[model samples]
Target: MTKQPAHIVVAGGGYVGLYTAHRLQRRLRRELGRGTVRITVISPEPYMTYQPFLPEAAAGSISPRHVVVPLRRVLAKCRFVPGAVTAVDTEGHTVSVRTVAGEEAGGEPLRIAYDELVLAPGSISRTLPVPGLAEHGIGFKTVEEAIGLRNHVLEQLDIASSTRDSAVRSAALTFVFVGGGYAGVEALAELEDMGRYACRYYHNIRPEEQKWMLVEATDRILPEVGEEMGRYAQRELRGRNIDIRLGTRLESCEDRTAVLSDGSRHPARTLVWTAGVKPHPVLAACGVPLDDRGRVRCTTTLRVEGVDHVWSAGDAAAVPDLTAPPADPPALCAPNAQHAVRQARRLADNIAAAVRGRPAADYRHRNAGSVASLGLHKGVARIYGRRLKGFPAWLLHRAYHLSRVPTFNRKARVLAEWTLAGLFRREIVSLGSLEHPRAEFELAAGSRRHPEDT
Candidate 1:
């Protein structure tokens, strides 16, 4: 009797899901062609976003279209399912998926059976119960959000330029970003730089008039780059007139006012939330063992702890750090792209080994270090015990991320854009109408009575 083909279902299309499937296609080319192995990737968005370029995308340094890789094009051999995995039945070896059409039509979820499961649903923004936050705050995790933020910031400038009311103008010019991590600092810095440069076009708005604030609960920023380097970053931002409020938390944002833990309040129209992220909710309902932090518990070999025929990695899994020293408190690998990309390769290798009845190898690597960009020509780096700052650091930051952006097409496009950007003035055009494309047409067609009538 001929053995049935093994079906592998990979959840999420971010770093882990995309890379794992891509590597698997190359590793199992013969098996895939012979109908002995099949791979399926499920994700909400068809493209996998390179999040490191989000700040540049928001700053208009690179076109947003080039910041994401199309999954169907990259993983030609793997079946692509444009849907979200709502739940996973590990014991039954099936996953319930809610496709985009099913969601719009309010239909039942589709169930898919798999011989092996790769849980890489990634993460969602870790939000708190802060009042008015849900209604007022913006997240910076997706390409849509990044581009939306860029348009919003420019729109605020337009508002500030035309508003007669002092209070309204003040609020419109004020921008507050919470969290001091890479997403927060880089985003705020890049936008701040762009905002400052764009002020030249506005006759009434001055760069100094725009209030850009960074609020963090911790006492330091850029903790990934070490304390000394973090301090250098803090000093660099502070020198740029950025209000760096360390050891402060956002208590509330009701009535367009940001109340902080330090008993300070700022009236701002923009409040960006990038505090942190937690594993996807599907992990909780996946019937798999999870660590205290809700990440899937996994062995060093990337196999799900105590669960056969299941594996996990990336932000969704708590992978042990074999390179860390033996101590009372164990160290888990940090959930960054550096580790996620590396872990995905290792995870793919282990899966291939399991298929061939070979022994799986443990995932291990010493962190190379951290590099962060604080806007153009300004950055901080701590690599191999050597510290760099300013222009050199900025150049290194670009070179490092450029080498890892995935796909030769993207790398070439990004490099060409950068070359053009250096020779030409930055584009400050605001395309806010993209958010509501039908608004003007609705008014002309008498579909709506007023502009505000959505």
Candidate 2:
């Protein structure tokens, strides 16, 4: 006889959903002895990308595969449905999702019913109205973008080294990164390190000739690392001949001319938009209460106001931080990996209590501090107010994240990759075709078309 599935749907299998599922497994292993509670995760992606290492991936410090955790493998007990949840029908107790082939492609829609729903759709690349930006600029968010940027940059090096045309060469060599935040700084730093090393292989190109600029609208960078570390980073980057512009916004990308709000202009081929991100729009669609910023409003217990069967956390939901009694979660928990992992655990525990009809626990955590790898052994770290700069911080950053990188197999592989990279030079080969989904489609269509006059 067929039995009903005791389903719990978790939307968006990034850090929050994936970890929450893992926690549920741990918490329910004994409960499952009685045969009850099933968990399913729905999202466009079948994996959770450890995004903090994206810069290193782009710089060839680590293999791309090492930075992402396959959701199906990690969440072995949970049903994995790869799709984008477009809407939620609270009355129907169901969610709508677009059953796509993958995150990189668009696909058909599907309706899914659920007993309990947890939305953790995560954020997208937050962009602005800068001219020609969309056509020319790239973001440093996903694995694809990191790989694409790496390939594009390496291809640029090849183009510059091979071409004698000055304008083309200049455009090919120039790389501009917009944003001074962690993503922008780390990516630019790592890529610049790669570029500098690559220049040695080019007979015509001088190390000093290549242009790189980091344009930040703010006066400083790495706000989380505090002022001292931020200043130190600026000095280190400047010593490496990296042009760091403060108080400037990228006004235009039209005509391949980079214009600044400060009235400066330069021609560059590469533009990386890593300004910041916003909460996913799915929070508003769930018909739950929301804050002014569209984040799901939750009390300290991580419960959605007036919604009995729903709970929220991570970048998608605004759960109050009781630790910050006087403040509102240090500005929505800064939307990073650290908070997401913690929030996922708390949410899991809270959800378990809700299911068993028990008092829920409150979410409260202190700031553990921030760490960023500048390039290679160069890094900055602030651990609970103690400031660190250079290699020591780099070690801490590696040790800390390596411990939190999900699976033991991946953790070992990542360590091995790091060890090998230190001994050998970077693999700077470009695999740009990874971005084009229809490279063969044109050939297929062209072959089918009537033979040309040729």
TM-scores of the candidates are: 0.97, 0.93
Q: Mind giving the per-residue lDDT tens digits that candidate 2 earns over 1-454? A: 8766556789898889889988988887665555677888987887899998899899988889988999989988788888788888877888888774433375445777887778888887788999998988999999889989999999999899898899989988888999999999999999999999988888889878889899999999989899989999999999888999999999999888889998988888888899988888767677888888778877777777788667778887877656654752354555788888998999889877766768888888888999988888899999988989999998998999899999899999999999998888778687787778689888898778565755
Each candidate's clash count: 0, 1
- Global fold similarity of model 1 (TM-score): 0.97
- What's the lDDT for all of these models? 0.94, 0.85
Name the top lDDT candidate: 1
Give the C-alpha lDDT of model 2.
Answer: 0.85
Error of 1 at 298 (Å): 0.5
C-alpha lDDT (0 to 100) for residue 149 of candidate 2: 94
- Highest TM-score against the true fold, candidate: 1
